[model samples]
Target: MSDAGKLRIDKWLWFARVVKTRSAAAALCEDGSVRLNGSRVDQAHKAVRIGDVVTVALTGRIKVLKVVSLAERRGPFSEAQHLYEDLSPEPPRFEPPSPVAEREAGSGRPTKSERRDLDRLRRPDD
Candidate 1:
């Protein structure tokens, strides 16, 4: 933690375990995938302070996190979780519709005799 109560966004992200590596965090920032208080951030050196909202766009989801504190080093998962407050919305849930074709229980496949009986029913004695 800096005496000024500010840390570089990339370092903070890495310290908080937001990304696998610091370089990845810096690249994310440089790619404009990070937003500080709703403003786009394209630099990794940008300063981040407590109580600031940081929005990040990942591969398939967006994360909104509020900085709670600054970290001095990359720490354990439990410790890293305290560095920020997650504000991301819940992901949508999809429920598949029931199948249209329903089969009777214990009915495997029709026997050869069953097929002949069905065919005779359809021929109408002709």
Candidate 2:
């Protein structure tokens, strides 16, 4: 809060709660999964300032955010939300995944009938 102009991207990510930890954020950046202002950046020490746009390849989808302000520390979700403005593209339509065979915990291997059912699910031509 003292000076919002001198913040690093990795720190901002952690401060904004985009990642669970600063090390994780640094790793995300160092892996070339982060783009700053449309250019790929593979360094955790890159400086980020207000109004800069960052596009990141996250686990499930890519996210784009605009830096709105700097943060001094990792904070609550509500506080983190104030650090950046989300500009990510709308995600594609949801498609529920095919049902998977599930059994109770500690149930061990599938029973004969269950195996047959699973086999049928695996190969509809069966």
Candidate 3:
């Protein structure tokens, strides 16, 4: 493709608001946390064109985006959103375990209240 038809991956990431800063995007690319069309991207200057799939690994989740358009400058979220079509899958739901006090009957040791009641019952008349 011609030069005009492509843009550097780092620039595109920043322009699309996928990352907070261009330097972060470059660091992500250098860290091999970015993938272009399923291939690892180790350089910030790699060229990306419309219709390419870009996968980015973030702290707790991964983002999959398809290039829909290119941008010339960083813009507002509404404008940036148009630059890519999000294809990321839904993140897994997390359900915290029930509290220890809510455990099933006879599952574990008695609670403090239970122990207090027991002690009261065991005490002689006084």
On TM-score, the stronger of 1 and 2 is 2
Residue 39 Cα positional deviation in candidate 3, in Å, after optimal superposition: 0.2
Off by over 4 Å in 3: 1-4, 98-126
What would the per-residue lDDT of candidate 2 be over residues 10-118, giving only the tens digit for each residue?
A: 9988998888989999999989999999998899999998889999899999999999888877878998898889999999999998657666799898879989988
**Compared with the true structure, what per-residue lDDT tens digits does model 3 show for residues 9-57?**
9999999998999999999999999999999999999999999999999
> Lowest lDDT 10-mer window, candidate 1?
95-104
Q: For model 1, how does the per-residue alpha-carbon lDDT over 15-63 read when each residue is reduced to its tens digit? A: 9898999999999999999999999999999999999999999998899
Q: Give the TM-score of candidate 1.
A: 0.73
Off by over 4 Å in 2: 97-126
Top TM-score hit: 3
Q: Which candidate model has the greater lDDT, 2 or 3? A: 3
Every model's TM-score: 0.73, 0.74, 0.75
Give all candidates' CA lDDT scores. Answer: 0.90, 0.88, 0.90
